[model samples]
Target: MLSRRSVAVATMFLGIIYLAFISLGIPDSLLGSAWPVIRPDMGASFGFAGILSMVVAGGTIVSSLVSGSLVQRLGTGKITLISCCLTAGALLGFSMAPSIFWLVLLAIPLGLGGGAIDAALNHYVAENYKAHHMNWLHCFWGVGATLGPIIMSFYMVKHNSWRDGYTAVSMIQFTLAIVLLVTLPLWKRIAVSREHERLDSMIPQDQVGPELKQPAISSKANVLQIKGVKQTLIAFLFYCGVESTVGLWGTSYLVGARNMTAETAAGWISLYYGGITMGRLITGFITLKINNRVLIRCGQIIAIAGGGMLLLPLPQLFLVGLILIGLGLAPIYPGLLHETPTRFGRDNSAKLMGYQMAVAYTGTTFLPPLFGLLAAQTTIHAFPFIVIAFIILMMMSAEKVNHILNNQTKSTGINC
Candidate 1:
């Protein structure tokens, strides 16, 4: 059993990872705030800006896959440390880059580091921590996401340069990285013993002789079955699409379509994230009381309703629509994350998270660019329609997944 102190330390480690994710968002949020100014400064066309956004999304997809493999090889702790360092370096590079090309190149490391930290930390917490901890851990991410834009907006309004804003965020990230590095040894000592024992138990005892022999069960073979893994992966892929599309594009829609100022748009964006924060806290309280599949499906319906509201002609409904979307999305990611360990076993959670994250990042990569392209060609008023389509797809995919899980539960007598 994990000791209380060990669990607390692990949760803190996950919190550090959330800080890394927040650091990733600082660049994104700052870009949203600074784009109009920076675009003119850089002499770039709107098409170029759209392509640049795609480039960052593309890097995220690639890095998510690469980091997943790295985590599988090096363990989460080492990968997280390396990711944080790379992320900080990437931010510094962004601060100093002389050209758009250089900025795009810097995005590579930023994406890699951010993707790795997200996958590794998510897997670690979902597998090892209690369910409530998973919700709370992601809530920290919501806090960071909310703060990043507000901080950038403040600096922008103060007549400070974008470089200063970027640099400030980088310094904060570096501080978190340092804190994580200092605490890493303690986490490793607590975790490694359990990992080794699990590894040892996987070996064939007959080949190692009587001393190595232990209880005979088919747990390993059963765990290796890939059918359910494929189903879950499909569910996660669309879920990623729904989640990232809303998050990355919603601010732009508000700015471009609704004629809100950048500051106002960002403020409204904060409400979306704020709703997520509150929703996750509520999710933490209710998950033990409610069935997860039911909660997830209900969330999708709420998200669809939110998306539909965005499509309506009423201007007053926009904020309410976004809040509904946030509440709907809040439970899905963490719920899926929390379910992984039970489905695949704790030992496989890291690699599974890596794979799932890779798939999810593909959605993140594909959707934003598509939205950007569409927004570039047409009015941003069309944005809500795109979101609506994704939400409906999420609902359908989740239903399939729930059905699959239910059938599996019936067949195997397992709760997953």
Candidate 2:
């Protein structure tokens, strides 16, 4: 527990984390909204999205895999501040890019910056904050996510310029970086406090032999050795695919398959993210009385129902489906993350989280384009059905993970 003075410092840093999370969202949603306009201006084909996305994903995967080492070396404070500044710089590059080449070139920093901050903050929050803050932290991200499209829409509607949206977001990110720099000391204090706790909790030398003192495996390697890790990884991977596919294709499916207008579809698409944000806002209250496992199970059922809605011939259900899907998706990611530290010991959780993010982003990186190919070969109507398939797979993976962890909890008398 924090002393009164450390508590005050933690409070300040928590506020800073919220801002950094917001900063994370600002650039993330900007691309999807602006791409419709950007694609045409850059003279790129429809398939160009895969290229750019692949590049970004590649960068994200690289940074996410190495995030553990980076955090150990640079500390979360320096990593967060530096990554935000890099992302801000990349955003500025995006605003000024005259061609698709420049955009592709800039994707490197954008992805790296985004990945590093994401892995670090997620571990930081899970290790330090309460379950409710995990939900709320993501809620703030949803707010930024929701705002990004709205900002782009305003510029698109008014000046027909997407550049202004990027510029505005860049300024916000830059401001956050400076704020983080000012609050650097808080990160140091909390980090030092965490290290002391870790050391003090270790076994005394008298209790264990030297041969048994050190782990046979590396910390990073031990992540995979955890009993339920495979199932957990699969759950996370499918979850990312399901969530990303729904968000990315919802607009195209509405416009092409349902014959909705682009403007209307864009507006409707925002409902998905809005539902996610709203759901987290509500989940914060509910989790006070419920366990993360129960909440996750409930979310999966709701998501399946939402996916079922999309399979109908009726077009109006699309919006409702998207909203429900968002709500269902809202709790899963954060809840799983919140469970990590306790499920696998705190020391191992950091590397596990980094690997989780890497795999999750890998799903995000590849699935949509594969879905795109599916849509191309079949029909746009396949979108909802494909989403349904992913949901089912995710549910199955989740069940396996539940079984594995529950058995461990029972046999070992440990609460996962």
lDDT (C-alpha) at residue 114 in model 1 = 75
Predicted structure 2, TM vs. truth: 0.87
Off by over 4 Å in 1: 1-18, 154-159, 192-225, 247-269, 311-319, 371-385, 413-416
User: In candidate 2, which residue ranges exceed 4 Å CA deviation?
Assistant: 36-43, 153-161, 191-220, 255-262, 313-318, 413-416
lDDT of 2 by residue, 1-416 (tens): 44788778777788889888988887777887788899898998887877887888888888888887788788889999889998999999999999999999999999999999999999899887778889999999888877888988998888878998888888988989888888887787887776675577667645754222322222455678887778888888889998888778889998988888999997877788788899998998888888777888899899989989887778777579889998998888999898887677777777788888999998898788799999999899898888988888888887887776556544643322
- Please tell me which predicted candidate would have the highest lDDT against the true structure: 2
TM-score of each: 0.80, 0.87
Query: Which 10 consecutive residues of model 2 have the lowest summed lDDT?
Result: 209-218
Q: What lDDT, from 0 to 1, does candidate 2 have?
A: 0.83
Q: How well is each residue in 63-138 modelled by candidate 1, as lDDT tens digits?
A: 6656645776887788778878887888878778888888778877887777778887787767555677677777
Clashing pairs in 1: none
